[model samples]
Target: MAPQSNRVVELRIPSELGYEKIAREAVATVAHRLNFTKEKVEDIKTAISEACTNAIRYGSGSDARMKVVVILTADEDKLDILIKDPGASGAPPIDIDIPDIDGMVEGKRRLGGMGLYIIRELVDEAGFVEAADDDEGNQFRMVIYRVEDTKTESSPEASASGADNGGSP
Candidate 1:
């Protein structure tokens, strides 16, 4: 078989409330082309949507004049996504915390802070990349593996069966 090459797709969208949907659709098309399963594709789409929404709302302050950049790198094994925003709202959060849904519903905690947490859970890896001295924006990255082997030693079933029991027998 021929060697697989990496394919990249870049998109620039205005930093507006509704622009995230554009990114959502674009990622869905790319993920489908990479032959990802329907569930995985849906996950990717949702993850990208949340990330882009954060970039638009917080990173660029939802300023339509600002632009949010999305870069997707597709390889045989995985897909890498990077989102760049103008950093108008200062630095990105250093850590992600689970949403306080109960508090929000009870009018104690503020609503709509679950984007990062959702993104983290949906993607294999999700984080804000540190920028170099010359860089001026926040760069957030997410990676999703294309294939997952159900019978691997790390699988839940294998672990439950003690397949990695360190030769205790």
Candidate 2:
């Protein structure tokens, strides 16, 4: 529930080691502007790191020089991210293998699929799309909803969607 007040920043990072720094800076600045809690800032930056890492590791030309685009938008109640990457070179399409959405493993996480997992855990709504041949490489979008609740409560609509309700699963 953003109060119709927020800040947004867009940065273009070339496929280089310094891309991570750009992402880090973007998160830091936006967090400061939004007055995000320390934990929220950490979550945002971490998610940004995963996104940039994927783009750099995957999107690039044979020349090993490419570009990554990162967009960060934050408000009093939400944070939205859009990341675009050409895609991993010479890489096969691999289904992202993640543990059940509600599961987590303490300190034994691998880097590959961990990004999406972490993003899901930290954010309220997260989604990714591989853009068409006509669009950018891989376009991923993640949204984090602000929370004021210490106890998790299910929305009626959400609960209904999961139940047979008056029909079937």
Candidate 3:
């Protein structure tokens, strides 16, 4: 496929626990076809899984009747993913905190809530897209570049930790 051309794949899965696996496998195939490295493909898979899980569980409340829509836009340079849910859980989080594993183990914090953080770390860009006036639910977006750009490299630590990493990827 031409580098400038785009291929789009859309999937609508039931709002249930195991359905996210479908999206995972579909994204993996697309990433491989786009010539993404093995490591990057793995990252994309995990990120999509987490995003879809969040959509099914929190976004649609696992209603089963509701459907979670996943849109995969494959380009030569990057793969863009958009997941839409019915927003049964209201607004998505404004911030993604570094997972407090220690606190969770110590019984000071909740065990889950790490999905968004993990997605942010794995992909080049990840966040909930602002919905339009007529839109009803949440639209989460994630983008993974096939090739890393060293010039614009930015570490996730700057967002997770207040300190900067001197532009390390």
Candidate 4:
């Protein structure tokens, strides 16, 4: 952890699968300093990895020349993760309902397209920033509140969740 004063940390890496290790390590370190539970830390690590992988695979299409920027902001009660894909055209809006976990685990449903679902499950809230048709970047954002134990809780905000509050125009 740099200093408690430095609430936001940024990392930019080539959009490749190999560099994902760095992302996981950085995220875990920050999350640990925030005193998140071990299980929560592991979940955040996994979710971040999945988000990065998806950004590389689907966003940049594994383009080595493109870049992925991960911004982690920690506050008194929550952590916000924003992943920007420089080459992504933004995901299309989807109207499908959340996948049924039982069916997914039972092999009755398709296996792909589970990253976003897993992210939504692991974090307090999840969202996407659609790039404009003329824009060059898209974003995936996640919000996780400090969950030291079952009794602790925090409120979710549109800004942190990247909801309809002008994350992208």
Candidate 5:
């Protein structure tokens, strides 16, 4: 169980392409409720989609039985997202050598390894972390810091959907 916070949403689903939307939707919902801007929420959604795709296609080998769990935590100043994939085995240590965005944009470097790069660019901080204590798995943690905005206002659609009512999942 996660510590009590302003908002927390947890989602678990099979490790398959068919379930990616669930993860994205859950993240988006939590982010929206946390008062994130639409663009930031979309960025979180895209990054999460890539991470989950890698987890399903590579980590779990597309196994439908394996589970992918996503936990979204939000406070007044930050939103932390953890995406866990309990694949066949734990992932080897990851050493992310910083990629040169300029070179990649200029076609000097290949465009294949942009998932993590894009994630890093999108969020304030992002990294892989140890999985749950009892679970042999890999976890990707992404953090986004929220800037204080006194004028921040919820859209009518979000208000109509009860986002301002402080729901939990």
Candidate 6:
């Protein structure tokens, strides 16, 4: 369970502020080093941003301040990110299931629910956790895994799951 390398960075996101850029920079820093392609890196950033954006929405109200925590970690052959957010009402639990794309139409649909769908598609591995909030509110945990090769994934510990996707692999 030891990472080859890891970095934990925390930032305060105002309800009126956007946290996507924070996610992009943090993921890019370690992903580039882990040999993730430019496109793959972008996908990973998108996933991370989606989750953070939701945390800002559901966790904290516009006037309240929230926290964005990002951890960049890797082994010799893989990369994993652990991002945690404490919600506005404190951490509301996150549902891992992808949102229905059909019902969430652009013209008549919701704008905010696409993050969970996109996050699953972009990452090789994804996991979410809702924690008990004392003063911080709800907490959500997102883990994205990036392994170097398909061969390595055949082992007992495969991080990526295809349950919520649309045959992307």
Count clashing residue pairs per candidate.
0, 2, 0, 0, 0, 8
Error of 1 at 16 (Å): 0.8
Cα RMSD (Å) per model? Answer: 8.3, 7.8, 4.9, 5.4, 10.4, 6.0
lDDT of candidates 1 onward, in order: 0.79, 0.60, 0.81, 0.72, 0.68, 0.55
Which structure is stronger by TM-score: 3 or 5? 3
* Tens-digit lDDT track of model 2 for 1-41: 23366567788788776566788777767766666678777
Q: List candidate 1 stretches off by more than 4 Å.
A: 1-3, 149-169
Compare candidates 3 and 4 on TM-score and give the better one.
3
lDDT of 1 by residue, 18-137 (tens): 899998999988898888889889989998998999899889999999999999999888889999999898877764555778999999988878877667657766778777789799
Provide the lowest-lDDT 10-residue window in model 2.
160-169
TM-scores across all candidates? 0.84, 0.66, 0.88, 0.73, 0.71, 0.66
User: Residues 26-74, candidate 5, lDDT per residue (tens digit)?
Assistant: 8887777777789989988987887777777666778998888888888
Q: Where in model 5 is the C-alpha error above 4 Å?
A: 1-4, 89-93, 97-111, 148-169
Q: Give residue 90's error in model 6 in angstroms.
A: 6.4
Pairs with steric clashes in candidate 2: 58-87, 58-88
Can you rank all candidates by TM-score, best first? 3, 1, 4, 5, 2, 6
Expressed as tens digits, the lDDT of each residue in 39-140 for candidate 3 is: 888988998999999999889999999999999998877888999999998877776767789999999987888888777777777778877889789988
How does model 5 fare in lDDT? 0.68
lDDT of 1 at 134: 95
> How does candidate 3 score on lDDT?
0.81
Model 6 poorest ten-residue lDDT run? 160-169
